[model samples]
Target chain A: MYEFDYRRPNTLDEALEALRTAPDGKLLAGGQTLLPTLKQRLANPSDLIDLAHIQDLKGISVEGDTLVIGAMTRHAEVATSPDVRARIPALAELAGDIGDRQVRNRGTIGGSIANNDPAADYPAACLGLNATITTDRREIGADDFFTDLFETALVEDEVVVAVRFPVPVRAAYMKFKNPASRYAIVGVFVAQNSDGVRVAVTGAGASGVFRVPEMEAALAADFATGAIEGIAVPQDDLNSDIHASAEYRAHLVGVMARRAVAACG
Target chain B: MTVTVSMTVNGEVVSGEVEPRTLLVQFLRDQLRLTGTHIGCDTSQCGACVVHVDGVSVKSCTMLAVQAENAAITTIEGLADGERLHPMQEAFRENHGLQCGYCTPGMVMSAIDLVRDRPDITEDEIRKGIDGNLCRCTGYHNIVKSIKAGAQAMKG
Candidate 1:
């Protein structure tokens, strides 16, 4: 790795100040993504502001109908938290299935959502469940959080503080994971809330994670696997790669959505 | 430039001044000479560099040594009680959990945390627990067996 200055700030204020002062500075949460990017020379930051020391960035809490998870909360914490599992079992299950134990243990929710990897699992949960992403600057809804491939609503120096997932009536996530990388080749998260039914697809979209309105409408009325039968997403909107074709991915969106609904049941 | 970091490693309080860019994995292996915590992939994909931070397993490869200041860490080297091997370690040996043994330490460390956190672990749970740790040799069959055996042994 290239040499760079490292600072471990105890408080978010100090960290934010350091980020403000430093040119091309990157915040280090779990380093599951950042470290790899650094090693591959994909990112060359002048300084690394380690956020692990900031106490406020960790922990999981349940407030009535919402599950408030700190930005820096490890995937393992979310996956295993009694409160999260009891309240949002699908969210917990989603956390548990992300990139194995080491990744879950080290990868933070903030890092995953921030990186916005097209194949990441959390974005689907965030979009499908209609979670609220709280940053130091302001709160962004899940619908607006994800913008495009490797893009998010967060601006530079705006740190994610927490993600508030409203307790859904029923929800589940299903993914066809790439065996080697464990990334989702095609994943779907089906959620039914008071607002209505929401279907989020990840690892299959060109614009990263996205929701399916047609599937949502079908499920909202019936909430059954057969509700979305023959509902094919457009191939142009889906992702194509060595693992799967765009058409295959489009087909998988329906199949995975069905599985997610069945699992939710 | 160096930063002073104070943290507990395997129940031992240790403090040192290290280069700002030094990784936590380097600190444990180079500074402390705890070689059991191997570095398989420089990237975070391989679980060979896993260790516990405040009782949670994290990829040391991704974290800087300075990030661990004042934190509690438990590496594979600290899992045993001097002469006696940790149950997970013993189970790996008995079940042939490893082939090259490069990923064994990390697998064992992750498994220990998994079993401790969920005592009622099932086969599927065990499979998902060590999903991060990759063993190209065993195809994860024997590794799963080792974790199950270790969980049973730790229960007693």
Candidate 2:
């Protein structure tokens, strides 16, 4: 790993100040992805502003019909939180199945969505449940948050404070995971609410997490597994790798969406 | 630049000056001479460096030594009580849960954390709980048995 200065700030203002002072600085959340990236020399930052010490950034609460999860709240906390389970059990299950137990203990919701890995699970939930990402500067809707693979709408100095997820009437996420990494080869999150039905696809998208309008329209009409069985995402826009072909991922999307719809029932 | 990091390890408060890039596993083995924590794969994929930080299991190799500042850590060395083996360790010995022994330390550490609160943990849960720790030897059959036995023994 490259040499760097480490600063643990007690408050958001101090962290922001540190980021400004160090020109090339990275905010260290759970460090699940950042630490590994550093070890491989993929990134070089002059300073690392650790966010673990900021007390206000760790919690889970429900406000109105939305669930507010603090940026630093770990995946394990989300998986086991009574509030999260009671309000959004599917979201809790998604959090529990990410990586593994140890990974869940350290990986946080803010970090997961901020990194926005194409194969990550949180983006699907964010998009499917209609989440609002509250940053140090402003609130960004989920549809506008994920821009590309490993990218987000966050500015250089901006910090993600919390994610506000509107509780859906019912939602379920199903993923065909890579055996080794446990990352989704093709994951689908299907949600039905009073607004309508939203079908979000992750891991298979070439751009990143995306919504399938055709599948959403089909599910909205019937709200059944068989209703969307024929609706398929095009292979041209899906990701293909050694683990699965674009055609296979396209096929899995239909399978997973159907399974997710069945799970929602 | 070097930073002074202090943390409670094995019930003893220890401090060391290390580079900001130094991993927690490196700090434990090189500076503190706690060699019991093995590094099977320097990458976080292998659970050979699993340790408890603030009563939760985490990959030590993925964490910076400085990140654990003022935290409570329990390594493989901290499990046994002076010549007497921990229940998990004893269960492993009884169940023949090891062959090459490279992955034993991590498996034991992860197993203890897995069964912390749950008394009647099922075999399927034990298999899933140790997903992070891989055992090339023993086929995980004995490891699963050992964790089940250990979970029962821990109830006492």
Candidate 3:
């Protein structure tokens, strides 16, 4: 790893100030991705502002019909929180199934959504459940949060504060995981909210997590495994990797979506 | 180039001075000489470097030593009471859960944590419990069995 200055700020204000003062400073939230990137020389930040000491960035609470999870809340916490499990069991199950115990324990939801890996599971949940990402600067809706692969609507120096997930009537997540990394090769999150039925697909997209409108429309009419029948997502915009081809991913998307719908039921 | 860090490691208070860029894994292994915590993968994929930070298991490889300042940590070395093996360790040994033993410490740490938090853990839950820790040798069958046995033992 390249040499860099490190600062552990106990308060979000101090952390934000450090980020504002230091050029090319990266905020270290759960470090599951950032540290590895730094070690591999993929990222070369001049300074690292560690967010672990910031108390405000951790915790989970229910606010009315929304589950408010702090940005720094670990996946393990979310996965095991009784409040989360009772209110949004799908979200809890999704968190529990993310990347194994270590990753769930170390990786934060904000970091996962901010990194916006196409194979990541959280983005699909965020998009499918119509969650709102509250950042240090502004709040971004799920539709506008993820910009592309490993990119988000967050500008430089903008830090994610918390994520607000509106409790859905019923929801479930299903994924075909890559054998090695355990990342989703193709994952689907199905949810029925006040807005209506939403179907989000991740890991299969070329860009990043996205909603499948056709599947959503079908499921909105009649949410069932059969509802997704004959609905084919275009393979042209899907991702193709050694684990799966674009067509295979498209097929997996439908299969996982149906399974998720069944699970939701 | 040096920073002062103070944290609770294995229920004991520890203080040290370290380089700004020193990883938490390095601190646990090199600085503190707590070598039971292994570093299998340079990336965060392998759970071989897992440890509890404030009762939550995290990948030590991804964190800077300075980041854990004033935090509470528990490693594989802290799992047992001196001479006795932790129930998870015993279960792993009995179930043939490990092959090369490289990932054993991490697997044990993660399993102990999983069992501690969820007493009613099932086979699928055990499989998902240590999903982050990779065992190229065991194919995870025995690992899952070990976790199940360990959970039962711990509960008893």
Candidate 4:
């Protein structure tokens, strides 16, 4: 690993200041991704702005119908938090199923969403449930927050503070994860609310996480596993690799959607 | 540039000057000479470097040494009390949980944390909870037995 300056700030203002002052700074949340990337020399930022010490950027709370989670909140906390489990059990279960226990102990939802990994689980939850991402500057809706593969609406020096997830009437996430890394090969999140039904698919899209209008519409009409039993997404845009074929992924999307719907009950 | 990072390791206040790129496993094995912590895989998938940071199991290889500053780290060396082995270690020994012993240290460390956090940890839970710690010796049956016994012992 290459040498770099490390900055640990105790306050949100200080962390933002550090990011602003550095020549090329990377915000360190759980360091589950950044540290490994740094070790491999994939990213060589001039400085690392450690967000672990920031006070306000940690915790989980329920405000009426929404669950507000701090950016620095670790995946382990989200998985085990009583408040989150009570409010959004499916979200908690998704958090619990992320890359093994050791990884979850250090990985954060904010970091996971901020990185916006195409295979990550949190993006599906955020998009499927229509969460609001609150950055240090402004609030960005879930639909607009994720722009592309490993990308977000966040600009340089813009730190994500918290994400607010509206509790759905009934929701669940099911993923066909890669056994080795536990990354989703084709994951589907089924969410139903008063607004309507939102079905999000991750680890399949060529660009990133996206909603399936057909599946959403079908599920909205019936809100059951049988409704989307025959759902078929385009195979041309899904991911195809040694582990799975694009056609297989499209098939799995339908299968996972059914499972997720069944799980919602 | 190197920085001084101080943390409580195995109940000892240890401080070391390391580069920002220094992983906690490297700091323990190379700098602190606590070689009980092993580095098995490069991609951080193998949990041979698993250790407790502030009472939670985490991959030491995936965390920078600077990040462990002011945190309490429990490595394989910290499990034993003087001459006696920790209950988890004893259970592993009694159950023949290791073959080559390469993954034992990390396996035991992870098991202790698993039982500590989840008291009623089932066999299925143990399989899932210790999913991070991979045993290349290919001895998972005894490892599961050891964890169940160790968890019960820890409760006693």
The prediction achieving the highest lDDT against the true structure is: 2
Overall local distance difference test of candidate 4? 0.92
Better of 1 and 4 by lDDT: 4
The DockQ of each candidate is 0.71, 0.83, 0.76, 0.89
Q: What tens digits encode model 2's per-residue C-alpha lDDT throughout B1-156?
A: 899999999999999999999999999999999988889975688798999999999999889999999999999999999999999999999999999999999899999999987879999999889999988989999999999999999999
RMSD each, Å? 2.0, 0.7, 2.1, 1.0
What local lDDT does model 3 show for residue A216? 90
Number of the candidate with higher DockQ, 3 or 4: 4
lDDT string, candidate 1, B1-156, tens digits: 777888999999998888877789999999999999989876677889889998878888878788888899999988889999999999999999999999998999889988994556898988876777878899999999999999999987
* Backbone steric clashes in candidate 1, count: 2
Any runs in candidate 1 off by more than 4 Å, and if so which?
Answer: B117-120
Candidate 3 residue B35 C-alpha distance from true site, Å = 2.0
Q: Estimate TM-scores for all models.
A: 0.93, 0.99, 0.93, 0.98
**TM value for model 1:** 0.93
lDDT by residue for model 4 (A61-174), tens:
999999999999999899999998998899999999999999999999989999999999999999999999999999999999999999999999899999999999999999
Predicted candidate 3 versus true structure: per-residue lDDT over A132-210, tens digit per residue: 9998878999999998988899988889999999999999999899887889999999999988999999999999999
Better of 1 and 2 by TM-score: 2
Candidate 1 CAPRI classification by DockQ: medium
Which regions of candidate 4 fall more than 4 Å away from where they truly are?
B117-119
Q: Could you give candidate 4's per-residue lDDT for residues B1-156 as a string of tens digits?
A: 789999999999999999988899999999999999999988888899999999988899999989999999999999889999998899999999999998988899889888995567899999998989899776699999999999988887
Which ranges in model 2 have alpha carbons more than 4 Å from their true place? none
